[model samples]
Target: MTTRILIAGGGYVGLYTALRLQRRLRRGEAEVTVVNPENYMVYRPLLPEVASGTLEPRHAVVPLRAVLRGSRFIAGRLTGIDTERKVASVAPTAGPWLELDYDELVIGLGATSKLAPVPGLAETGIGFNSLAEAAHLRDHVLRQLEIASATTDTELRKRALTFVFVGGGYTGVEAIAELQDMAIDVLAGYPELDAGEMRWVLVEAMDRILTTVSRELADRAMTELTGRGIDIRLGTQLESVEEGELRLSDGSKFFADTLVWVAGTRPQTVVGELGLPVDGRGRLVVDQAMRVEGHPGIWAAGDCAGVPDPETGRVSPPTAQHAVRQAEQLGDNLVATLRGEWPRPFRYRSRGEFVTLGKNKAVGEAFGREFDGALAWTLRRGYYATQIPTWNRTIRVLGDWLVGMPFGHDVVNFGSREEPRGAFEEAAGRSRVG
Candidate 1:
């Protein structure tokens, strides 16, 4: 009988695991199935570029069907899992829930934004986690500039020009830097809005930013950002947000039309509902082999799994590098189990880390060697371009970069794309009335 392997979530773990299985499995040895809500997987690292108009939104995502030709693709969300019956429930876009049976199940459901209980935050703040959010941010930022330029009220202009980002990690730092760079680049186009008028603030509860990198590199990034007139408030917290007015922990209040919440992320809510062993952080408790504890044939990896780091003996940080390695290991172990061979533990050493700080500017460490400025930027770009999967997407991403270098930032706001049918709807309504 052929082994049925169902992989849930089409993020880094799901895609890589399926790819590994496709390559290793003998013909008819196992049937691989991948189910995800979206048909495409967003290459999250390029989201900052997407937000800054450096890369097209479509290029940052990989079509699941196009790449996973060898595996069965199901466009749906995993509703639940029945471990005893070896079945999983899925809810498609518009249909009854479908149940799937599998010999082995892989949980790679990934994570969602962890929003704080700040007043009005849920209503006002925007997250930079998804492709839609990133693209919307680009259009929103440009719209804000237009609003600032056209507004006669000084208060409205201040609110429109003021942008606040909460979080000092890779997401917050990179996002603010890229958007700020874009705003500055396009400032010349708006004669009414001066560069000095726009205010960019980065709020972090910690004393320093980029906690993942060395203090030296973090300091260097801080210097670079501060030099660009971005206000970095360390040991500060966002107390509340009400009616576009933000009150900080340090007793300061300001109005900002744009508030990006990149504070942190937690495992998806559905992961908790699966009735699996999860850590205090709500991540699935999985062994180094990426197998769920006490659940044979049930595996988990990536942001949804609390995978023990071999080196640190702690739960591995949810990074793309670690997720890819874990997925590969999970795939091999599954294959080994099927072949009646011993499996190996997942192990990975830190090769390097890169943090992009706008166009032609970055900070990173590779092989114990620290780098900053343009060299770090180039290294970061090259690494992501190669890692995004598929030759087609790789070419498109690089082409965007190459084409953008000469043309500079594109200021055209396609916000109307979101409401593409609005005009048609109005026309139809007018005709009906007539």
Candidate 2:
């Protein structure tokens, strides 16, 4: 009987794991099947550029079907796992949930935004986690600019121009920086609005931002962002975001139509519902070999897995750097297990960290070498351009970067794309009655 291997989640872990397996597994060794909601795996690191319209959304994602040619791709989510019977229940977008039996299982179901009890946040706030959100944010920002420019109401303009972002991590910082830069570049077109009228705020509960990198690098990032009139409130918390008004624990309150929450992420609820062993942070508990504890023939990796760092003797941080390394190692370990050989432990020391502060500006520390300004910015782009999977994506991303060099961000708002049928429906007098 052919061994059936099931992989869940098509983020970094799922894609890399399946890619490695396809390369090593022979024609008859095992049948690999992957289940994910989307047909493409987004290179999430470049999402900031997508939000700023610097990179096309299509180019930033690797097509799963094109890359994982050898594996059976299921455009669905793993709704449940019947581990006792080695069966996985997959809920596709249209069809009823079906169960597939597998000899081995690899759960890499990644994470989702972990929101707190801040009122109105659920309704008003958006996250920076997916391509949809990134694209929507780009259009949303441009729409806000339009509202601020054409409106004469001072209060409405102030609210439209105010942009508040919670979290000072790399994701939040890069997102706000890129979008802010886009806003600044487009401001020249608005004759009535001064750049000073726009407020960009970064709120962090910690004493510093970008704590994953060196303190010096974090301080440098703070300096650069503050210089651009970004309000970086250190050691502050978001008290509430009620009725388009944001209140901070520091006793500050403001009205802003845009609120981006990039605080952090927790493992998908399905990870916990699978009856697998998970850590305190709701991540799958994996041994050094990337195998889930007490679960034979099962493995987990990426942001959803609590992979141990051999160097630090602690769980590795949930970063793309770690996810890529862990997925590679996990794939190797699975192959070794299939071949009746000893599996290897995942061991990787990060080369360094990089944070982009808009175009041509960044702060990074890699290989014990610190870089700032254009040098760091160039290095950041070069590194990601090279590392992004598939030459097709790499070339396209570089092309976008090169083409955007001499020009400012495109201010055209494609918000209408969200409701493409709206115009036709209205013209036909078929608008839905409330």
Give the best candidate by lDDT.
1
Question: On residues 1-434, what C-alpha lDDT tens digit does candidate 1 reach at each position?
Answer: 99999999999999999999999999999999999999999999999999999999999999999999999999999999998999999998778889999999999999999999999999999999999999999999999999999999999999999999999998999999999999999988999999999999999999999987788889999999999999999999999999989999999999999999999899999999999998999999988898899999999999999998888998887788999899999999999999999878999987899999999999999988999989999999999999999999999999999999877788899999999999999999999999
lDDT for every model? 0.94, 0.92
Best by the TM-score measure: 1
Candidate 1 versus the native: TM-score? 0.98
Residue by residue across 1-434, what tens digits does model 2's lDDT show? Answer: 88898999999999999999998988899999999999999999999999999999999999999999999999999988887999999999787888989988999988999999999999999899999999999999999999999999999999999999999998999999999999999988888899999999999999999878778989999999999999999999998988888999999998999999999999999999989888899999989998899999999999898899888888998889989988898888888889899999999988888899888988898888999999999999999999988999899999999999899989999999999998898877854553
Off by over 4 Å in 1: 432-434
TM-score of each: 0.98, 0.98
- In model 1, residue pairs whose N, Cα or C atoms come closer than 3 Å (at least 3 residues apart or on different chains), thus clashing, are none
Q: What is the lDDT for 246 in model 2? A: 92
The clash count of every prediction, one per candidate, is 0, 0
